[model samples]
Target: MRHLTVFDLDGTLVDTPRAIVETFTAAFGALGIAPPDASAIRATIGLPLGQAFGALLGLPADDELVASGVRRYQIHFKEIILPRAPELMFPGVTEGLDELRGLGITLAVATSKVHASADALLRSAGLRDLFALVVGADQVAHPKPHPESGRLILRTLGVPAESAVMVGDTVHDLHMARAAGMRSIAVTYGVHGPRELAEARPTWIADTFDDVVGLLRAAPKGLAG
Candidate 1:
């Protein structure tokens, strides 16, 4: 059966650690606020910008500081870092994606990035054409762990919950998939680690991008129930 595979952008399919760190640092610098430690910043990735800012700053989501910080962060990423940084696709991502497509699986992205920014990044990595749909933070009222984005992707893909999988590198991804009644696959090379991901109970854990391709090829039954 054909599958609808929903992938997360930053950690799962790409290593964007540089862009994330630099942007957050620059934004906080611009605002005269000391940036959170690098590890703390990295840990909160895969969340919405507002939420991430709130967590790092110890403020409410609706606080003006978080809102302003997010805006400044996007500005720095767009105007400064994006032009100079290398493309961020993880090793084997393109080959794995090609193989998964060859297996007749449909691919889409559900990420915390804004639609335009995520599209630009994917295009830079030459992976944009592989996705049937791209769902971004701006497009959804709520981000991952809320299930709205995953539900939207599955609906748009016309794939049943049981016939799809959510591949990502964070607990939010696993929780979102489970809440959507879809299978979840966590990749270790991303932001979070196995110990944390295990708490979310993914259907499977992949060590490399190729392992994801293998999982889809094997099409393990009863995984997405």
Candidate 2:
């Protein structure tokens, strides 16, 4: 049986940390607040938009301030992030995925980013057709750490979670995969890094998307569908 390879967008598939920082800075500046600390904002990369906004702005997730923060962020990211998205696709991501696709593995992209933006970025990066399933924060009823997105992606691919691997850069990804009863591969070269990702105890921990392919290759057979 072919296994599934489910990926997280943003930190895992694209290196948007620098672009995110720029956008967030634009957001805060647009709001006339002292620009947020870059490291703090970057650390919040993998989280859902509301949570990331709230945390960055020190507002409750449902607070009005959060709305404002989101508006500010959207104003900039929607316009700038896509074009100048940080080119952090590591050294081996595209080629790796291409090779994996040639292996007849099922691939999907699950992201905290909105569907439109995720699709655009993937296309802009020349990776549009690589995924059979594209699940985004807006496409699901719930976000990461809530299994819904992962479950949805697996359902779309007609694959059981047990036969899939979720590769991401955060605990949130691990949590969602675990909730969906799938194995998780943590990539450390993103926002969370290795230290923060250790708590998840991923099935494998790789340092780059390039390195992740080797890890998947080494994974038990029938795991990278």
Candidate 3:
């Protein structure tokens, strides 16, 4: 009977594979470094920019190279990628969200994207006003998998962890839910597969956005009708 739902933005709600791939590719070129394969970039979508850059480049998390890469990625993403091809909501996203809202469920966003960018993306996609809270990676001391973002969202929304669920597409999202002591629903159509999400042990797995809405509709007595 989860009353509060925290969602991961990039792959779960919005389709940003193309923007991510192109941004990182352009960023790597800006740094005069060889670009990682597109798959490599896709695999790191849910992580914070610095961590994603570190993972893609095989550098230490705090390395100067990682910082430089993150900066470059942000620049290209804002200046070129976002303007050229802003990410769009995935199929059924708006409808599912609308249905959930109608059911009196509170929605929030917990994403690894920086605050301004995350805000702008949601606004551009006509979703900024839908979420009750939008916790960004930069707003927290630690991002997903550490639970800072999730915990903050729950606290701000005044929702108990046990009465909330994190809906996401990546292991990071599931792990963050577990770490925050909340239930998790993993979607398979995002950045990661069921095998990867299973490693994080989500309470449920959804194949489509409508399936996620169904899960909410079936929630306990007070949560759903």
Candidate 4:
């Protein structure tokens, strides 16, 4: 069993992709830039907000445009995204979480979202108390695809990366887990399909949150928790 379970927020636990996409559209319009394709915006779900928008919208990653994009999104996010949120938290998510908690597993959230947003979403969705620690972008020096986010979570939980499993719905999460030397588990129901996540080399892949619990239970010793 995995001793430490790290999760991604947006696409992994909550289906807030619509809110995210709409916020990006508003941001682009505010900046006088063309909005990205809907699918491309959706595909940005699990990446770091700035990096995701920069990559999808063709904005220079290191330029002020990226910062402006984030700022613009924040302007409308409270009114648009937050109001539209607290969406589907995925089938079996709470159940699996409860099961893991019962088994004495430590849970942490390693997400690129700001801490306030992540906390609000979790509290609104009745999952605020599920995690022992919430390592949001506000708390981490680096976002996903970088090990720092996961490392911070692991540090907070007092568990080594060897004892952790990172559960998310994107290649970014997979890459993050890999960078942290933690096991990676992908779910197909999130932003990226199985095909897209396949190239990330996850240790396990599931179609649903329920399947994820099963995989975790059966995962070989020393792999997770």
- The candidate scoring highest on lDDT is 1
Per-residue lDDT over 158-212 for candidate 4, one digit per residue giving the tens place of the 0 to 100 score: 7878888899998989999999999989988888888889999998898988888
After TM-score superposition, the amount by which residue 125's alpha carbon in candidate 1 deviates from its true location, in angstroms, is: 1.4
Estimate the lDDT of model 4: 0.82
User: What's the CA error at residue 70 for candidate 3, in Å?
Assistant: 1.5
- lDDT per prediction? 0.87, 0.82, 0.87, 0.82
Model 2 score (lDDT): 0.82
Compose the digit string of candidate 3's lDDT tens values, residues 1-225.
Answer: 448989998988888866889899999999998899998998888889988998888889899999999888888877764553334678888889999999888999999999888887888788888899899999999998888999999888889988898999999999999999888899999889889888888989999999999997776453321
Once fitted onto the true fold, the runs of candidate 2 whose alpha carbons sit more than 4 angstroms away are 220-225
Model 1 lDDT tens row, 96-126:
9998888788999999988988887788777
TM-score, per-candidate, Cα-based = 0.93, 0.92, 0.92, 0.88
Q: Show where candidate 1 strays beyond 4 Å.
A: 79-81, 84-86, 220-225
TM-score of 4: 0.88
Candidate 4 clashes between residue pairs 3 or more apart in a chain or in different chains: 2-224, 2-225, 3-225
Best-to-worst lDDT order: 1, 3, 4, 2
Candidate 2 structure quality by residue, lDDT tens digits, 1-225: 777889988878888878888888887787788877888888788777788888877778899877887778777776876765436566788899997887777889888887877888888777879889888898888898899999998887788877889999889999999899899899887778687788887888988776788767766474534
Candidate that beats the other on lDDT, 2 or 3, i.e. the better one: 3
User: How does residue 173 of candidate 4 score in lDDT?
Assistant: 91
Segments of candidate 4 deviating more than 4 angstroms: 220-225
Question: Which residue pairs collide in model 2, if any?
Answer: 3-225, 106-225
